[model samples]
Target: MKTSLYNIFSWIRFTFLFVAVLMIWALRTLNWIWMRPNRLEKCLRKQGLNGNSYRLTIGVTKESAMIIKEAASKPITFSHDISARVLPSVHNAIKRYGKNCFMWIGTAPRIHITDPTLAKDVFSKYDDFQKYYKTNNPLVKLFIGGVISYEGKKWAKHRSIMNPAFHLDRLKHMLPAFHSSCSDMIRKWEKMVPEMESFELDVWPQFEALTADVISRTAFGSSYGQGTNIFELLKEQSHLTLQAMDSAIYIPGSRFLPTKWNKRMKEIHEQVQASIRSMVNARVEEMMDGGETNEDLLGVLLRYNLKETQQNGVGMTVDDVIAESKLFYFAGQETTSGLLTWTMIVLSKHHEWQDRAREEIFQVFGDRKPDYEGLSRLKIVTMIINEVLRLYPPVVELTRIVREETKLGELTIPAGVSIMVPTILIHNDHEIWGEDACEFNPERFSEGVSKATKGQVTFFPFGWGPRICIAQNFALLEVKMALALILPRFCFDLSPSYAHAPYVVITLQPQFGAHLTIHKIKH
Candidate 1:
């Protein structure tokens, strides 16, 4: 009877302890989702910032999605003013709450910053305002994570090692690969065009192919065939990622659930990593056996990595190499292809600019293959490319998060509030770009990007400050080469079937297609 009474007492004690722990967990979660957000909202209000009232766990995300969906349902008429259609929710928010406002992206408040000064502050102080993880969805990292995702010392180390690969001398060595890819693409286009007449075709996919091929050749060199396979997988992965994001707001730990999107994303990531890992291993083996290092991106990176390891006793691992290489493929293909696509569309609209660009191209190259020296000399072509970038930047906006309280000019930004620097909005700002900000005037960039922005942080198509896109020069060179080759070969104008719809999937791309009639030049 004594033993039975002791056992009952122990069981009762254990039950109470379990319930106490459960209640504590529930209270903390409630504080995180409710109490903390309300506190942040009140704090922002005290500072005179305006925004919609926070709504439960979803916040304004659902409302924003609905607006975006409604805006994307139909294409706006042909005009350079695309800010509304592209970012309807943000645009609406700005209109309603003015510039000095914040919006809830889930529980976190994302403050819109149009002021160039504050944008500069956020960008320059990379450590304070870190790279924003767009969503809490852990699976999103599978597609977008890489060197760009790292912060502080890790970012510095990766940047230092990769810097040599994009040096002017190294880029010049990759010129042959660029020319070869462009030539192949042009040859295919010529085949598509009839002997002495015009043939209508979609140039969007053509540019995508051209850029993909260029990246493959420049990045992988002799192993370009395999690189092509990786590019395709990445393309599909991007689409799946967008779908997953559009489907729902991420619940923490939901990535582990056996969902279809989750499964496919994991599978694609594994495949890409496996393919890249195999290539990296092969190259490392070659180096270990005292084989000569090729000047391709992978080879150059490995060479530098080895040097770093030998000197500092540590370097990037195979996984690190894989991540960087994956970045090269995605960034290289997307940025250039988007630029080239928009260039063609813009040039077609402004025939006079096209004539002048062709005149300049002829003056520089004149029925010969474009050399780097000749490419640099084509000033008119450079201006046109710059104008296109301003009007249709590959990336629409940049987001950064502050982990701790940070001061930006007069405002004191609390920890966990995100900063939204809308690149598209800044690029088209009347105050910054003048009255003709929305117009496609290449003449504005005649004195170069620095002169055009008047030494402000306004024009950052490739981004701004230290953490700018590393391959901006590489992308620009490729564009110059492509435009040089195509201008002397054909005259292009938009086909009647074409629709003027530009939307962002991964980058700003045509909603319909870039259907243009290509008239083969009779030389």
Candidate 2:
């Protein structure tokens, strides 16, 4: 009787285990098949959005891929407007389906938010609407880490740690770094010119090098000299990341798959991390060896990190330091370069405004180097930069993913939806900026950005609300220094080869080049 009972119990256990496994598999299949699409469609209907009825499993992935492929194949043109090439598809969808519309890209439902009030709501509730796109592209993930990718407590902690580095006093101390970088650029340009005579050259690369130099000097101090080549490697890594995005949908563990591109990406990611790790280790050691705490950004950040570690005994790890350092390198370099390049392009086109800017620079400094105090006095120069940012924002679009069901304005945004706030569209909107919205006008920002947007959330070059860019002051200061040096030393005109194609590769950048004819200023 005992043997028979034990045999029956053993059989029961095996049967139960088999049933559980089958149930789990069924649920996973259902999630992929029915649940995801149903949720997406219901959310859109509730939000009063209209779009192509989502087809089975794949949804609109096939159509979206075709559009992206076409955009990629188009020949590069300097005169063609970037928005003109890409906005039609988006605009047509909105026109057909109304303002709050949904379009599928893979399994994701991209909800377009064009209304200023809706945008304001999305920007303000950033914690709820957070960045959620995860990819198999390793380099992209590493470079864009930190507060930009983080949400909730992680974001708050990182932001708190980084805030002190960009303080007003701290920026003032770093003015020399900016000056030194700009001075290097001017010297390079002077040598390129034939006996300092008029010549046409692409200014995009110059702006890039200047910003790279600034980030290197300010971020790593002596370490930048050692890590200069690594900066170039990081730039290459950025390009590879963009290429990786063009591939088909990536599943979990996709990077481990036996594809040549995947292997190359993995290698690059490893190399970048290795380089950053070495620099971070060296800096930590130098700080430990009785080195004076300098006021540069990296120095301040390291000192703060050390203090936090000592006090809490559970502070940021070496990996965290490396991640933040990469963030500083990419974000610091890209933003300043974009701002300076666009500002230069706009100032070149609008010669009268350029003259006013040069006049402001002359009146404020008079051929002398612009100090932090003197840069502040150049009101017209500041206005020109602000106007350029409004027209060609460094980040053309800001995205946030909804993790849980939330009400944005009157619409209920369901979980796993992407809210896209196109900064360029709003900035160039006729209703918002009047009839001459697209025109390059500095006077629009003369009274300040508040009046420029007509009290709406229209002008958000550095973003808006609680999650607004932390490095706005840092970027502005760098721009002020570069403009102060360039406007007084050289006059520039848009070259015939200059292209107006502004494409988004992490940041909005000239697709071809920013060609300009430069003539030395006569004293």
Candidate 3:
């Protein structure tokens, strides 16, 4: 009788476990479907926000894809006014619905925040929001691998070790490196010019080379010359990644499926890794030889990581060092170059500001090479660069995914919803900057960006808060140094061949190239 009772109890326990497993599976499937369309609409509606009704499982995916396709098909223009060009869909949605509205991007509801106060709130709670959107292409992951992809504890650890490398004092020490790189550019341009006549030239490549040189000198020190081929391969990889990104469907294991592009990308990645590893190995060997210290960024990073590793008995591995070095190589090269290219394009259109900036550069340095102190004193130049960043930000958009149920403003964002903050839209919002928001007016920055945004977090070319670009100062100093040298020595105007096609790969870049007419300034 006791054995019979035990058997019955065991059967009951088995049935209960089976029912719980079934319930969990059912809930997960329902969550995936509802989370995209139904739940997103309900959450927005609860907050008095209106937008297109989510359509079943597809949500807004079709509409978002259509917009991207259309943008890609159009011919590139030379206008720096991206807000005017790119705002039709977003503005139409806002016009149809209220200011606070949601739009669909591939079964994901994108909530648009035009209110400065609300934008501030979103940026303030950055940690709660992460950049892991559902549709992130695997190719993109391969290209932009580093601290940018990390969140929470991992992000904290990487950021802590990397922060000291970009401090202002270190950037100041790197000013000569910035100047040397710019001087190489100026010399190259000087050799290219035939007589005093204005000649049309593509400035994009020049900017690219300048930034590459700066990154090489500043980040790797003596190791840069050896790593040139690695930079070239990385640039090729960037182009391939963009091509992969344009395709919609990504099957499982597609990146390693032995396709032509995949093979090429793999080869490029390996070459870059090998180059970085060689440099790192050399540095380690040098450290072993009599403890001679190298003060460059790479050396500083290696030493710091080594010391930390020794103390903690575990820190960033050699592979970590290689990953980060590649990241710096690409990110540092692309960002500053893009910034300078756009700034040059904008300045060419506004020659008065160009002359004014030149005058300021002259007053600050007077034909002498720009130093850290002199670069800071050029407030007008700073304003011009800041204004250019607002109009043609290098990073046009930033995405954040909700890891948990989080409250943003009055809305409860369910986990897995990706929030995209379009920097261009926010920077050029008429409500925030008044009627002249779209115009390139450096005077807006006269009272400083804080006052300009009325204490809201509106202008974020380098982002805001803790996760802001680590190399903001480095990029700025490089720009100031380059402009201070170039503007005084040459007068430039937009080339007729210039096509103003700004698009995003890893960073926002000219789809064609920045063509400008350059005439040497008579000293």
| Highest TM-score model number | 1
**What does each candidate score in C-alpha RMSD?**
1.5, 3.2, 4.4
Candidate 1 lDDT, 339-412, residue by residue in tens: 99899988888899999999999998787788889999989999999888999999888889999999988888
Q: Which candidate, 2 or 3, would have the higher lDDT against the true structure?
A: 3
lDDT of each: 0.88, 0.78, 0.80
- lDDT, residue 402, candidate 2: 88
Which window of 10 residues has the lowest lDDT sum in candidate 1? 242-251
CA error at residue 468 for candidate 2, angstroms? 1.7
- Total residue pair clashes for candidate 3: 5
For candidate 3, the TM-score is 0.89
Model 2: weakest 10-residue lDDT segment is 77-86
Candidates arranged by TM-score, highest first: 1, 2, 3
TM-score of each prediction: 0.97, 0.90, 0.89
lDDT of 2 by residue, 175-254 (tens): 88898888888998888776558999888888877888888888777534666676777777777776655444666676
What's model 1's lDDT at 102? Answer: 87
Report how far residue 81 has shifted in candidate 2, in Å: 5.9
In angstroms, the error of model 3 at 342 is: 0.9
Against the hidden true structure, what lDDT does model 1 obtain? 0.88
Best candidate according to lDDT = 1
